[model samples]
Target chain A: SQQGEEDPQALSIQEGENATMNCSYKTSINNLQWYRQNSGRGLVHLILIRSNEREKHSGRLRVTLDTSKKSSSLLITASRAADTASYFCATITSYGKLTFGQGTILTVHP
Target chain B: DVKVTQSSRYLVKRTGEKVFLECVQDMDHENMFWYRQDPGLGLRLIYFSYDVKMKEKGDIPEGYSVSREKKERFSLILESASTNQTSMYLCASRAGRRALWGQPQHFGDGTRLSIL
Candidate 1:
């Protein structure tokens, strides 16, 4: 069974707009990580936030984690056509295994 | 930079044929993982190894087996490939929690396996 579920299965926006993707998990986790995958390509590491952390930033990407809600969100500011890709959230539990969410497909139009 | 390599980028096998997918990580991380990605399913874990010779089943492990004879290499085996088994296979590696430091996993380019 999948432990995490992402909302807005798909999103579309023009370049320079901001995009937000949300993820919700079912179990407690030690940390949460986000990844980006270009179509038919490998996954690229984006960012990770521990349970104790509330927010993190990497370049134009921002991530927020709310353990009380067991949810997290990824924000991509000033999106570009190159930013179009599928985003996924993975939860690492105490047991040391990662459970991934379905993912969100973001399409940035130029 | 950490590098994780998969043996093949594309593979084609007939039904009932045994298939092997190899992954090697250069960083000598303590953990390695195998996952399969589908159109809508995102990525599902097939197997993982925490240490040399130690393996664990992930969320979807049926019809699959793993081997980890070396600290830097992990192998995923398909006992009998089926059409349904065709998908993109991904390999990843991570150091222990302390070294990982809440960082995302490093992934291989992936193998596109087609079971006919």
Candidate 2:
């Protein structure tokens, strides 16, 4: 069974707007990480929030983790057309395995 | 920069043929993993190796095997290729020892395999 499920299978937003994607996992995890995949490219790590951390920021990206709810959200501020990609949330198990979500397709139209 | 390289961007094989997909990492990462991606199914891990000559089964390991002869290289093998096994295979490597799963993974571009 998949551990993480991403909400909003697809999302469309205009440039300079904010984009938020949510992910919910079904198990206890040490941490949650977000990754982006461009067309025909491999996944690139974006941001990671630890279990004990509530919020983290990296440049225009903000990540919020709610361990109590077993969910996390990634926020991209002032989105651009280059931000168009498939975003996935991954949950790490105790055994060092990562289970990825179905992913959210975000298209930032310029 | 960390770079995980897959041997092929695309591959085609006939059913019942033996197939091998190779991956190499340049960051000297201690962990390597193999996954297959399909539409709506997401990426399902097939196998992972935490060290040289060590391997473990992942979520869906049926009909698949792995070999990690060296620390920087990991290989996934299909004993007998089948049509249903066709998918986009991705290779990832993380710079962590066993049980240190918080680190981010670097991925290869992936190999689109077709089993005819």
Candidate 3:
């Protein structure tokens, strides 16, 4: 079963604009993480936000978690063509299982 | 920096043939995992190991078995490769002991398996 579901399966934006993706999970999570995958490559870790943390940031990435709602959102500021790829939200179980979402394909037009 | 390496980026196998996919990590991390990704359905876990000689079944493990004979290497075995088993296989490692959560996982480039 999928633990997380990402909204807006595909998004197209121009460079220098902001892109936001939302994710919702079914069960409680120990932590939630965001990852970026270039074409035909492995995913690269972006940021990790614990259940207790409502918001966290790393460079151009911002992650906000709402435990009460079982949802999270990722915000990428000043998008670039380099950021054109699939973004995934993974929910970590207490037992260390990482279940990834369907992913949102973001295309940034330069 | 932690590095996870998959044995192959592409593989082709015939139905009923036994196949093996291997992954290695250089960080000596205690946690390793195997997952398969398909379109419309995200990445689904197949197996995981917390330490050498230890294996645990993930959500989908019916057609797969895992081997963890050494600390740095984890292998996924397809007892009898099937058409449905063709997908992108990913291996990931985390820096946690005893299967604790909260740390980010490092992933290999992935193996795109095609079973005929």
Candidate 4:
């Protein structure tokens, strides 16, 4: 019973293009966070949007959250070959534990 | 600059053998988590600890166990390694909201374990 699930299992685009990944979760949450993983390494936190916040931005990364729909989307603009990685969305429940989505594999070809 | 460190980058173990994966965080975060990553299945949580000597089971905690004997250390244990258990193990730590507004977690490189 995974609480979060991401759409578009795999995505490919040219460098400098914009990539968008969406995540949907099944329960009430306090916050949602996005992370990026390179190869098989640990995840690097990218951005976090609270349940009360509708959108957030950090550099070229933009994240939008629709708590009413229990969904979120991450947009990476000006994608680079280095941006090729697995992206995951994690939901933090009121109980304090995080449930992660399966993840979306994004490949930015040079 | 929070630093989370894993003991090994890669590990190999024979089936039925015991395995231990260790993680340490320098920021003294109160929450620590252990997860295993596999193809298609993404990352599955094995266990997490909110404080020393406290542990909680995650979604897939069945063949695994965990220990948090110290504030900055968390260890994942496998009683009997199996081929199915071979995957990349990741550790993360986070401080509560008091420190910052939704502080992001810090992750270690990871331990790639292969059970033959």
Candidate 5:
């Protein structure tokens, strides 16, 4: 069973614009992580937000987690064509099992 | 940098044939995982190992089995390859330390398996 579900299965935005993707999970989590994957490639870790943390930033990426709401959001500022890829949110269950969401395909047009 | 290498980037096999998908991590991490990715189902875990010779089944372990003979090597075995087993296989590793939940998993390039 999938633990997380991402909204807006796909998103299209122009370069220099901000893109936001939301994810909601079913159960409590120890931490939430965001990853990016190019077509036909493995995933690359982007950022991680612990249950206690509400928000985190890494370069041009921002991640926010709301434990009470069991939701998280990823924001990419100043999107670039190279950022065109699928973004996924993974949640670590209390038992240590990691579950991933369906993912959000973001297209950044240059 | 941590390097998790999958044995093959692409593989073609026939149904009922036994297949082996190997993964090796150079970081000496103690945690290794195998997952399969489908179009809309996302990535589903097949199995995971926390240490050498210690294995656990994941969400989707029905048609898959995993082996962890060495600390750095993890292998996924298809006892009897089937058409439905064709998908993108991903291997990931992470440090097995305190607060393992806080660390991120490093993934390999993945293997696109096609079973006929």
Candidate 6:
């Protein structure tokens, strides 16, 4: 079963605009992670935010986690055409297993 | 750099034929996993191995079996392939808790299997 659900099944925006995706999970998690997948490519890990951390930033990517709400969000600043890909949020259970969301398809128009 | 390699990028097989998907990791990680990605259902874990010769069934292991005879290699076997089994299969590996630099799972370029 999937542990997280990403809102806004699809999104489109002009280049340089910021994109935000939200995710909500059913159970408690030790950490939450975001990944990006280009067409016909393997998933690449973006960032990881632990339960004790509320927010974290890496390059143009920012991730926020709210343990109380069992939710998380990923923000990509200054998006580029190359950012046109599928984004997924995964939660790491206490047992150390990773559960992924259905994912949101983000399209950045050049 | 950590590298995970899958044997085949694309494979086509007939229904009821036995299928074998192989995965190898260069990092010598302790944990290796197999996942299947479908259109609506994101990525679902099929099986995983924590050490050599140790295998565990994941969420959807009904028609799948896994083998871990060597430390650096893991294999997923389908006793009888079905059309529904056609999907993108991904392999990933990660360092165990004992590693100095605890890293996230590294994935291989998935194998797209078509059971006709």
lDDT by residue (A1-110, candidate 2, tens digit) is: 88999998999999999999999999888889999999888999999898999999999999999999999999999999999999999998755788999999999999
TM-score of each predicted structure versus truth: 0.95, 0.97, 0.96, 0.94, 0.97, 0.96
User: For residues B11-31, what per-residue lDDT tens digits would candidate 4 score against the true structure?
Assistant: 999999999999999997899
Each candidate: RMSD: 1.5, 1.1, 1.2, 1.7, 1.0, 1.5
The CA lDDT at A12 in model 3 is 99
What's the lDDT of the predicted structure labeled candidate 5? 0.93
Question: What's the candidate order when arranged by decreasing DockQ?
Answer: 2, 3, 5, 1, 4, 6
Give the clashing residue pairs of candidate 3, or none: none
Error of 2 at B99 (Å): 6.9
Q: Which prediction has more favorable TM-score, 5 or 6?
A: 5
lDDT of 6 by residue, A1-110 (tens): 67999988999999999999999999977678898999887888888888899999999998988999999999999999999999999887533568899999999999
Task: Write one digit per residue (lDDT tens) for candidate 1, span A23-94.
Answer: 999988888989999988889889988899999999999999999999999999999999999999999864
Q: What's the TM for chain B in candidate 3?
A: 0.97
Question: Model 3, range B2-116, lDDT digits (tens) per residue?
Answer: 9999999999999999999999999989899999989899888999998899999998999999999999999999999999999999999987664456789999999999999
Model 5, docking class: medium
Regions of model 3 farther than 4 Å from truth: B98-100
- The 10-residue segment of model 6 chain A with minimum total lDDT is A90-99
**Candidate 3: what is its chain A TM-score?**
0.97
Q: Among the candidates, what TM-score does chain A have in each?
A: 0.96, 0.97, 0.97, 0.97, 0.96, 0.96
In the order shown, the candidates' DockQ scores are 0.63, 0.86, 0.86, 0.58, 0.71, 0.56
- Candidate 2 scores an iRMS of 1.1
All candidates' chain B TM-scores are: 0.95, 0.97, 0.97, 0.94, 0.98, 0.95
lDDT of 5 by residue, B1-116 (tens): 99999999999999999999999999999899999999999999999999999999988899889999999999999999999999999999998876774589999999999999
Better of 1 and 3 by DockQ: 3
lDDT of 4 at A28: 86
Query: Candidate 1 — which residues are off by over 4 angstroms?
Result: B97-103
